[model samples]
Target: MDIQTLRLFTHLAKGLHFGRTSRACNISPSALTRTIQRLEAELGEQLFFRDNRSVSLTQAGEYFRAYAEDVLQRREQLQLQFASNRELKGSVSLYCSVTAAYSVLPDIFQRFRRGYPQVHLKLQTGDAAAALPRLQNRETDIVIAALPEKLPGRIIFLELTETPLVFIAPTDYPGTVCHSTNSEQEIDWLQTPFIMPDTGLSRRRVDQWFAEKKITPHIYAEVAGNEAIIAMVSLGCGIGVVPLLVLDKSPVRKQIKILACSPPLVPFSIAVCTIDKKIRSPQVQAFWNIATSIENAYKKGPTPHMKNGVSKN
Candidate 1:
């Protein structure tokens, strides 16, 4: 019922760990539990499913989550309106794949920082599947991911660009198939070893494409992170399947070449994922506007396409 309790629940839902949420809010674990318990008791419903080691939102918890955000957001807006705006302030947390963190986040952060220096930006990187539940739970305010379709629940999807899936091989390597953006002959899947993202989204797309040709990838290694895939290809581990953006001024840019393709593999979309935007504060709104600018200036992000994190060691 209280705003502080609602905010506590929101963070708890995102972390799904009472201890972590308590740490994040700078409160004790017992206090965190009591706050949620009070709120749940007032609502006459359970908000979380607490197991011995972990927690998850129940069906009723999920419903409470939406209304809780609404309440907290409205309360914040009222406070903002009453205060003499001394410059926009507050925090915006974001979760994204490694590529987006590298290639996509810099300018957005730069512009956001210049406009409202008081606003805090907290960035975290994870795979596509891991980010969604965090957004749903309000752990982070924004998410950047490469996905084929829509998000679940009240999350809002903001499309940035449709990126092509391209193959990359080392420059000194002699395959002679990857130097150009186009190809005339069928790529020999049998001869080449593949380096692929370990996550489900990339695996599914690659699997479906290979399934049609009745060709199984000769994977030399299954690596995590886009930079490592590119680095491994440089050391001649295997050719990698990654978004084209990763190749643009990448760390080992000169060392790799983009492979030729017939029709190209599936094009994954780059988008800014968010909790319902309307509930976002004015400072958050301002940053969202800055992020929506699709110009090449803001196009490159923080991690720039390493599947999970940007690199593997």
Candidate 2:
């Protein structure tokens, strides 16, 4: 019935968990239940099917979720249009990996804060793999992510930097996984224990690399975040592939060593990505412009020096 109500519904639709949605929306579980009940009563239809163990959207809920998202997006646009002359206000949610938050966003945040003090930046950090899906779901306005091989049509990305994907092994562990092999051909891929990403761009790239080499990897573990992979490798779990940027920023950097491969893994083009419509919001546009300016500055500036295969500006 109202913007807040619609927001709650849409967020719940995405997560499909009453407890998480209630906590995120800053409402008590009882209040959230009452709110949904009120909405269902008003609409004369059940929106979600809830049981003790699971929650799911009904057919009506799916249609209403789409409607709610459109309405919320349009409201943001309308607000932006009406307040053209006023100071830019409203929040822009951002999603990125923890490494990106530390390495990539500081300059952009500093500039944005100085220019638009009234605007709020809500940052959420997790696996880089979730960035695009969260953006598509309208959960976040902007994301710092690696540019995928084939970008989705609904999203726009601005390249910020490029980082090589490298293999890493434990420095202290002199196990079979960390054995010194002069070249890719010398190593026995079947016997080597390897840590790999469970999903996302890096995972696909690694998969392709293995396929081209015509070798089935001896996977030790499948982890979610690159940070986690670094941690596991540092513990002598297995050699893992991760972005050089992530490795450089990792706390256990000293515990890990980069391994040379015959054919190096393709580098990742890190970028800021957002849906086409969200970019049109005034606050979101301001953030994008700041990122754009930074990107342009980097282009015009001297090339960053390479430190242990990581670029340093």
Candidate 3:
């Protein structure tokens, strides 16, 4: 089958939505249907089983998908092998949090664009926690997110910046425990309503902190994103924990105060994550090079006067 058809099939396999795949591939639904039909005719098997509500790969489809992926990879390698060094072209699918999209992506994109003008960059922003799973599933080419303490296998991490995880509470909060001047006084953490993330590396870290301190948190609310937790904290809902980087960029920065924990929380190591095999594609490698090349810039922190989504000093 043609490479374009294989590409469409791969997208379809991941999304399991025909309309989405068609739109993403920039093709008419009817045309996509025809292409799949042609492939099925050649292979003598249906690639997908679809009904009104859902779409799924057939057993044959799953097998075909593996073959298609291999063929596509080989095709890319062949193209890269023959193509002139001056030009690089292909799409790079990137996943990152909304925070990362605004904060870190602009600089990465600027460098990437200059290096590979012909490459198509597709960036999708969501929960920072979900980035790794999407990368593992091959749904995205790369992810920009906070790295876990124990690294996962078969992935490469390019460290970007380290930011402390800070505890925050509303400035007007009436909780005397956080405001106490007596360091010897014990705070009743069980009575203090706490806001935290439902999942993600931040949540894991917060849980670890509580465990190490031998305190069971009175979890007032388990929220989704750090931005949401910050908002809740700003509204006097409860105390929350989040990366200092996020707090610096938070719109409600003036609403909250950073609380002093007896022992400081560990800083988060933010990085660009990608699977080892996918980077073999020249387009992915091109972006990877750009991201790594700017490591020093990120380590030095955002420049003064709002340069490239990072805040000024």
Candidate 4:
């Protein structure tokens, strides 16, 4: 089928609403329906089941959509492949959560630039949850996140940095702190100020872990990014708990300290993810390879459980 039909179909599959998909495709609802019909005729199979207010992919549609997407991917790659032949000069865009943005990604991008000086790079940061859909839409070449809740048939995941999530405070201003991912004494840190991240699974994990322990510290602030949290803590606004990776050496040694943790903290795995290999461009693959190789980028220290999630400099 035509690329336009496949493009329209891809958006339809995601929106799953005729009016919504039609609006997105910039075509009338009837025309969208006709395109789907034409695609079905060409393939001898229907692609969707529509029953006003609800839409689901037929088994045939599901299978064809997979192939259709591959076709679309190849069509895009063709141009990139040609460009690579000429010279691998184009932007490789990545979407990252703020944690990765501050922690591992800066170093990764630096090294990437050192090696691939001719290649341009673009990066945007947000909660991983917010960034994965952009990956699905092909808005970014790859993404660094905590991994999505579920992997759709169309994407791929590469384990990157598994860094320990830790409780930290300004180097000089500690009241009392405990170290345990499983559980900690609330009384120890009750009066200390807590900084909550605005969003992310790790934020949820920290929140739940505290709630279960029946400990509610006085929150210094609720901030949008890990960088801001660290900055606040470094300024001694209050003690803020953060992923250890977010604290680089100059900042960590001079500004923040790892408060004594009895149980140590739970760790979270960070990974590089993108559309499946068949769809990912070479530049994406090259960057992904380099990232995995630089495993020591953001470690807080060394430990068996922390290897994948925690980075120690």
Candidate 5:
């Protein structure tokens, strides 16, 4: 199979959804189906189990996924090796939440492009929680993510910035689910309808905060992305806990108000994460170096501070 075909297959295998894969790959659904069918026919094996509701990788598909990823990665390496005498001319896949793309990526992208204009950057924005998993699965070369409490040994994290985790509620909600209480005892933690993260570093921090207070949170909804939680909270559905960075970048910032928690939730340590093996790639290394320079500049300069859900230098 060709590099482009293998890339499409690997992306489909990771997401396991036809519509999403087709949209992300910029291909018609019917065309994508035909491509997969051709691959299966060429291999003489069923790669994916497809039905009306869901799609899943078959046994053969799982095996081929590894092979496909290896081939794609090697192709990138070979391209970089040949272009060493000239300019860097390869693609780097990046995954991050939309908020990160807006807040964190602009400067880095500007600088990287100035240095290596030939390097193509493929960015996929989605739930922040999925960043590490996508990186580990080799669906992307690098990801912007929060530093997990227990970092995997195979992953390398370079700190970019930190933001406090804060509780937020709708400003014009009809009910009294939230109040401006200075003490934790004054707030009704057990009765409040909390919108929590489905999984990720923020979820773990929120759970730990609740456990420390010895209060079982009344979870009203479990959302996948922090942006979704913000949207839900804006609709007067329930209060949510999210990073200050996300809150700052949200379009509905005026609709939501940050609530006071006596002992505030732990701040998130945002970073650029990549697998150990991928770090050796020239394109990946170039991106990593730019991120590292930004991190060092932040350390040496006056860091921005958050106030009233806004960042000020």
Candidate 6:
């Protein structure tokens, strides 16, 4: 099979969703199906088992994923070796949260673009909660996200920087129970209305805090993104939890105040994560090297918490 068809199969194997794979590959659904069918016929094995509701890789398909990845990595490496010394040309797809895009990407992009002008950089932004899933699904080549307390075994991370997970409340409007205070007793966390994250590392951390404190949150809303939580908190809807870097870059930074809890939440490690196999590609390695190099320079400068598309404060 041709390399392009191999890529399609690989995406299908990872995604298990025809529609998502089609969109990501920039092909029509019919064409994607045809490509997969052609691949299956060539191999005399069905790559995917499809039903009305779900799609999954067959055993043969699982084995081929490793083969496809290896082949693709070699192809890219060959191209890189033969290409001119002056320029590198290829595409790198990246996924990150909106806040990370604004706060950490500027430095990386500035340096990357200057060195590899011909590279086509495709950036996709969304909630931090989706970062790991998208990377694991092979939907993106790289992801900027917070490292969970128990990181998955399949992923490897180049830790960029760290930010504190702070409690925020509205400064202009005071609530009966939620207010700006350093003491745990001064603010009734259990009784206070909270704008909580619906999913993500932040949500898990929050849950841990609540469990340890033996306090149940009076959740006002289950927000999907940190930005949304910040917005709700600014409206005086309730107190919320967010990374300090997010709060610092927020347009409504002046409207909210950071609270001090009795037991400070563990800081978040902002990082660029990728599967172990993907790093074999020359393009991935090049970018990873560039990203890791930024940490030292980042530390010597103004904010020690920011680097490698990650921030902590």
Per-candidate local distance difference test: 0.71, 0.84, 0.81, 0.68, 0.82, 0.82
Question: Per-prediction TM-score, please?
Answer: 0.72, 0.83, 0.78, 0.60, 0.75, 0.86
lDDT of 2: 0.84
Greater lDDT among 2 and 5 belongs to 2
User: Residue-wise lDDT of candidate 3 within 60-138, one digit each (tens)?
Assistant: 9999999998999898778789655657777899999888888888888988888788899998887878888777656
Off by over 4 Å in 2: 12-33, 48-70, 178-185, 295-313
Using lDDT as the measure, name the better of candidate 4 and candidate 6: 6
Rank by lDDT, highest first: 2, 5, 6, 3, 1, 4
Worst 10 residues of 2 by lDDT: 304-313
**Model 4 TM-score, all chains together:** 0.60
Candidate 2 structure, TM-score to reference: 0.83
Give the runs in model 1 whose Cα sits over 4 Å from its true position. 1-5, 13-49, 52-71, 83-86, 126-130, 172-191, 277-279, 298-313
Residues 181-300, model 1: lDDT tens digits: 353355666667788777655667777777887777777887766667778888777788777776674788888888775557887777776756433567567767776652534333
lDDT tens readout by residue for model 4, 96-148: 86667766677778788887887888877765556666666555678876653
lDDT of 5 by residue, 1-313 (tens): 7887998898899888888778767899999999999999999999999899999999999999999988887886787678787878779999999998988888889889998899999999999998987776667888988877677657877777778889899988947384326754366766678998999888888889888989898899899999999999999988989999899889999999998776988788888788877787888889888876753322222764211111111
lDDT (Cα, tens digit) per residue for candidate 2, span 139-250: 7889888877777667877777788999888998857463326653366677779998999999999999999999799999899999999999999888899999999999
Alpha-carbon error at 297 in model 3, in Å?
3.8
Worst 10 residues of 4 by lDDT: 304-313
With candidate 2 superimposed using the best TM-score fit, by how many Å does residue 250's alpha carbon deviate from the native? 2.2
User: 140 in model 5: Cα distance from truth in Å?
Assistant: 2.9
**Candidate 6 local lDDT, 192-227, one digit each (tens):** 898989988988889999899888888889999999
- Mark the regions of model 6 whose C-alpha exceeds 4 Å error after superposition: 42-44, 63-67, 84-86, 176-185, 295-313
Model 6, residue 216: what's the lDDT? 84
lDDT of 4 at 199: 73
Q: For model 5, where is the 10-residue window of minimal lDDT? A: 304-313
Model 2 backbone overlap count: 0
